[model samples]
Target chain A: MLEINNLHAKIEDKDILKGINLNVKAGEVHAIMGPNGSGKSTLASVIAGREDYEVSEGSILLNNEDLEELAPEERAHKGVFLSFQYPIEIPGVTVTNFIKTAINESRKANGLDELPAKEMLQKIREKAELLDIDRKFLSRSLNEGFSGGEKKRNEIFQMAMLEPKLSILDETDSGLDIDALKVVANGVNKLKSQDNAVVLITHYQRLLEYIVPDYVHVLHDGKIVKSGGKELALELEAKGYDWLK
Target chain B: MELKEKLVASFLAFENKVSVDTDSNVHDIRSNAFDHFEQHGFPSKKDEEWKYTSLKSILKHDYNVFPEGESAIEFATVKKYFLHEIDSYKIVFIDGVYSSFLSETSHDGYDICLLSAALKQPKYKTVVDHFFNTIAAKKSSITSLNTAFSKEGAYIHIPKSTVVPKPIQIIHFSTGNEAELLLQPRNLIVVGENSHVQIIERHQSLSGNVVLTNSVTEIFANKNSIIDYYKIQNDEKSASLIDNTYVQQKQHSHVSVNTFSFGGNLTRNNLEFFQEGEYIDSTLNGISIIGDKQLVDNHTLVMHKHPNCESHELYKGIYFDKSTGVFNGKVIVEKEAQKTNAFQQNNNILIDDGATINAKPQLEIFADDVKCSHGCTIGQLDSDALFYMRSRGIPKKEANGLLLYAFANDALEKIKIPELKTRITKLIAKKLGVDLGFDL
Candidate 1:
């Protein structure tokens, strides 16, 4: 469903992602694991069309369409969703309102009618129940003064709401406790389908235990140095990233 | 002659036409105010208080000091400007003349009538004598100018221990009857001890005519009274307004003033609060959103004369194009006013490179036991917040608008009136020129 061909991207004259290649078919969970400064997040951000990172070479293709020229929002319209490592705190915009705006804006771009309020509320209720988020949490400002675990859970909740074709979870388990990590992973697992794909970018193999990846790729020094089956995650977890370095 | 000289020259003829009891105290007050305005004329930019706001350019117009004739305005034509959501006491004026057809004045229990009626009637003579032009700033030439012509405006007087049944709305509409018009609306509100009142004031120009409003309002909140005052400054681009509002609070009284500036060519607001007793609370809040060459200047002063008094001030501005905004907030705590708590904050966002914001927060505290803090910030939109919103499938323009609305929402949260809050929310959205498909 998504293909990255020798992607070399840089930010402000400094190369971040260099000579990276990855391909994921439908319904596959791909885990990109690496230590800090390994460009794991950069690859995810580039695929999500973050404008700060210029594509010095190669292309990111979704359904054989090159996404180099599309905006971040355009890429989002084309079913690219990036769960930020640190979600932004948008004060005065309620979580429900923010998700509604995102959903309606995407629908508008796709020339679809706005989701009916009743149906939207029903979907929100179902998703919130799945994530175990309180109804009061939906009324508060988006990510303002939220706990770390709550922020990560809210990100996964947005993923559930958007139901994107390809979802990139960038450090989605960074700040989560054991229970929150389980809840987030459970939500992602429930949302998985044969028509969509999931890309997990993390520094640890801890999240891989919950949503087991079909393919594991070790990203090091701006390139995916190794690719293997799910056992590769257990091998890397048992042996530190220093061994690979 | 310039507008200042024309007003000075036309004062006598203007005074002679309106016959008042020469023996009354208001007569002498008017004469003294006229002399004060004549001496200072129009404030120059060199004046410290008027440094950022210059009346020199706006005063160049040939404004008619006395727009004598009344032009009829259909209530349906301008009904949207009113707080049509709820019932209100409306004192509406057209071309400086009271439009009874469009006004809903009250005299049942509390007095919600015209300032002219209060000044002329023997029944309301005591109120007129006690409160008329009493608390206005004498040093402000523009204020003195309003006091000199302080004849027609909304007069609201709530007796002791009474709550006004409905909020009063003072709206002045200029119908473009004259080539250039100058309107002076004088408002006097006296909320007695333990009384509560809310007032909303607005000035609108119906046509693209040069209209300048020099307005003065004096509010006296007696002991244990509560007052909520809102000023909506959204006028035609050809209209300019200089609003001078003075609020005097007694013991245990709370007064909040919220000014929402969304339109107008140039708007200068001089809001002052004077605390006379202990445990008084004064809140000053403002939100300004403007584009083009429009300019808005908000000058505020809170004087803490008694002990155990507190004042809070917050003003936020969002400027686009070449629009300019000025916020000058001053808090003064006297030596005897021990335990005074004063906080002032001014934050601004410049949407365009050409847009400008000059924010100055001044605090003068003589009391040793006082908690006084002031903060000011001038910045552009947060790039990180913008990208975060855009990354969520929202366009850049809508994202910026959403962030801007969020920035201003901190100030908007202080609106006590729900309907007014909704109206101002829509106004902010419209001012940002974005259709976020939802109300902020």
Candidate 2:
């Protein structure tokens, strides 16, 4: 479902991802684990087309379409989603309204009419139930004064709403407590289908216990130094990243 | 001749046109105000308060001091300017003349009428004489200019313990009767003890002609009274407005003034508040969204004179293209005003490289026990927030508009009327050049 060939990316003058390549097919989950400052988040950002990072060399293809020149929103319209580690707090924009706008904007980009209000509400209600979100919480401002767990859960709720083709979870489990991790993992697991893919970028192996990955890749410096399977996560957790370096 | 000299020379003709009794107190007040204007002319950039805003270009127009030939406008042409969804007491003026046909005044248990009638009639003379121009700055040159020509405007008076069911809408329209016109409107509102009132005022020009409005408003909130005043300055690019509003609050009174500036050539708002007794609450909020070569300046002041009084001020500006903005908020807590709590915040966003914002927050606190804080920020929109919204599938333009709307939302949250809030929200969305999909 996604392919990266020699993806050399840099932010300003500093090189982050140097000559890295990865591929993942539909119906599979991939985990990219690295220590602090190992370009794990940079890979996710580059895949999502964040403008701050420049892809100096090579290209990224999603479903055989080059995403080199696509903007973040264009990538989103093409069914790419990035769940941020620290969600932006937009006061005065209710979560439900934000989700509605996002869904409608995506629809509009695809030459479709806006979703009817009734259908939108039903979808929202269903998604809220799936994510265990309160109706009152949906009416509050988007992430304004939200707890860490609530923010991550809200991101998962949005991911469920959009149903994107490729979902990149960048450090989504960092600030979450055990209960929130379970809820977020459960939501992701239920939404997984044969036509979509999930990329989990994390610093620890705790999340893998809940949502097991089909493959595990340890990113060092910028390139992927090691590739293995689910048992590799437990091995790394036991030995720590110092042994990999 | 310079516009100042012409205005100075037109004072006698103005008085002659009004044909005021020479011995009346109103005549004396006008004469004294004219004298002050003649001495100071118009404020220059050399003055500390007028340092950032220049009036040289605006003051050069040969404005018609008094418009000739009465011009009547069809209500349909100007209906959108009013909050037409709800029933309101409207005091409308056209080219400095009271439009009785377009106005809906009242005298039942209260007075919601024109200032001219209150000045001439014997029944309202006492109320007019005591409160008119009492809180307005006597030494301000432009305010004095408005006072000198303050013959017609809105006059509202609520009796003690009376709550006005309907809001009062005071609208001023210019029909472009002259090549260049100058309008001075003076408003006096007195909310009696335990009374409440809400007012919405706007200055609009029908045609693309040069119009300069120098307006003055004085409001008195008696003991335990509440007042909410809204000023909507969304005139044409050829229109310029200088608004001077003064407010006086008695013990336990609450008063708030919200100024929304969306369009105009050059707009200056001078809003001040004076706390006369203890436990007074004052709020000053403003939002300015302008583009092109337009400029909006907001100068606000709050004086805490008695103990335990609280005041809050928040101003937000969104400038696009080559627009420029200025915000000067001053709060003073006197020594006798112990336990005073005052807060001020001014946030601005410059969308273009040519856009500019000058913000100054001045806090003078002589009371050591008081809590007075002020904050000011000027920058472009947060790129991180923008990227986040765009990543959610919203286009860049809509995301920018939404962020700007959210930045200005807190100030709009204080609108007491639902219809008015919706109208202002639509206005903001329109100003931001986005639909926002739904009412905020």
Candidate 3:
């Protein structure tokens, strides 16, 4: 469902993502393991259609629909979701209100009527239970004054509500404790289906044990140097990125 | 008297020729204010308050006293406005004159009347005289301008120890469309000892052309009484006006005023809060959104006359399309007013490069034991917050609108009236080009 051909991008005239290629079909989890400067986050940002990243070359397609020229929100409406490395603190915009807007915008793009408030609240209750997030957090401003783990869990809860076709978890486990990590991983794993895909972008191999990946690719210097099965991630966890380099 | 001759001949001739001429107070104080206005006329650019704005275009017009004509505020408009969100007493005014035909008040344990009629009452003359004596002294030419041309004013008196459940709603409308008109709408509210009441004063103009409105409001909160006044000035874009709000608080009394200046050409607001009693608390809040060449200037003063008084103020503004905005908030604590706590903040987001905001938060504290702070911030939209929302499925326009409304919520949320709250909500939505459904 996702394809990238020789994708090249830059920020401030410096190349970040040098000619790289990757493919992930539906019903699969891919783990892209890279060191600090291997363009792991840059790739995630470019795919999410962040305006600051300049795409110098190549085309990225979701189901063969051109994704580069679309605005960030338009891309998001097309079933693209990104869990930020650092969740933003959006003061005064309540979490429920934010989720409602997101869900309605996506529904409008799909030519569907927005769900009524009562129905939306009911759905939010179920999602919050599955994601292990307190209803109190949802009532406040979006991620305002929240702990790091709560922010990550809230992001996953949002993903569950929107039900995007492709989910990019960029450093979702970076700042989470082991307990919070398990809750977030459980929420993410519950969202897996036959027609959806998940790209787990993480530096540590511990998260891979919780949400096992079907394919593992060693990314170095903006290029995938090696490709293997789940065992490859375990191997790198033991030997580190030095082997790939 | 040559300048007076010019004013009476050219200006009063236009005032006499208006189609709808209402009764005006030709009293000594107003006549003296007019004499003072003849010397200063309108404030010039040399005046610190009028530095960013020029009333030259307004001065050039042969302005007359807009007379009281037929009102367009029928039952349908009131229902459309109040929305029955909360129970409220409605008082309507047209072209600076009271419209008793369209209004009804219970006078339930309260003193409420038109100043024109109240002046005739022997018992209420002392209060009227006190207000007339001190209002212009509370501010600058803006109050002087209002005092100079006040055609009509509203009065309300709540008895001691009573709490009015429903808020008193005042609607000031400029109905006639002859252009080059002037209106001075005045309001005087006195809450007796231990009484509490809320006041909502709304101003609007039916005509799209120019209307020069000089309005003044004097509020007196007696010992242990509380009065909350809100002013919504949605005048015509071409209208030039000066609005002055004066508040006097007694010992342990509470007073607060929130003014929303959303529409005006060259508008100025002067609010003065004098804490005359011990342990009194005062608050002044304002929000102004300006577009085009519109200018909205607000000057506020918080004076702690006695010890243990407190005052807090916050004003936010948004400017676009070369609009100019000014905010000057001053806090003064007397030498004996110990333990005085004063705070002031003024923030503005200039949406366009050409738009400018002159913000100053001043403090003059003579008390040795006092907590006084003031701050000002002028910047554009937060790009970080903008990108964060856009990263979600929210569109750019909707994102910007949400952020803008969030920036305004600090003041808008303070509005206690639900009907007025929702109306202002929809007004900001429309201004941001977003759809909130309940269109104003």
Candidate 3: tens digits of C-alpha lDDT, residues A1-245: 88999999999999888888989899999999889989999999899898888999998999899898898888888888999888887666688888888788778877999888799999999999999878888889888789899999999999999898999999999989999999999999999999999999999899998999999887888888898999998889889888667
For residues A119-238, could you state the per-residue lDDT of candidate 2 as single tens digits? Answer: 999999999999999999999999999999999999999999999999999999999999999999999999999999999999999999999999999999999999999999999999
Candidate 1 residue-wise lDDT at B330: 89
Question: Which stretches of candidate 1 lie above 4 Å from their native place?
Answer: none
lDDT of 3 by residue, B287-356 (tens): 8988898899898888887888888798999998899998988888889999998889898999988998
TM-score of each model's chain B: 0.98, 0.98, 0.90
What C-alpha lDDT does candidate 3 achieve relative to the native structure? 0.80
lDDT of 1 at A120: 95
Residue A46 error, candidate 1, Å: 1.8
**Candidate 2 chain A weakest ten by summed lDDT:** A41-50
Q: What residue runs in model 2 are displaced by over 4 Å at the alpha carbon?
A: B21-23
Residue pairs whose backbone atoms clash in candidate 2: none
Per-residue lDDT of model 1, residues A206-229, tens digit only = 999999999999999999999999
Task: Rank candidates by DockQ, best first.
Answer: 2, 1, 3
TM-score of each: 0.98, 0.99, 0.91
CAPRI-wise, candidate 2 is: high
- If ranked by TM-score, best first, what sequence of candidates would result? 2, 1, 3
Chain A, model 1: TM:
0.99
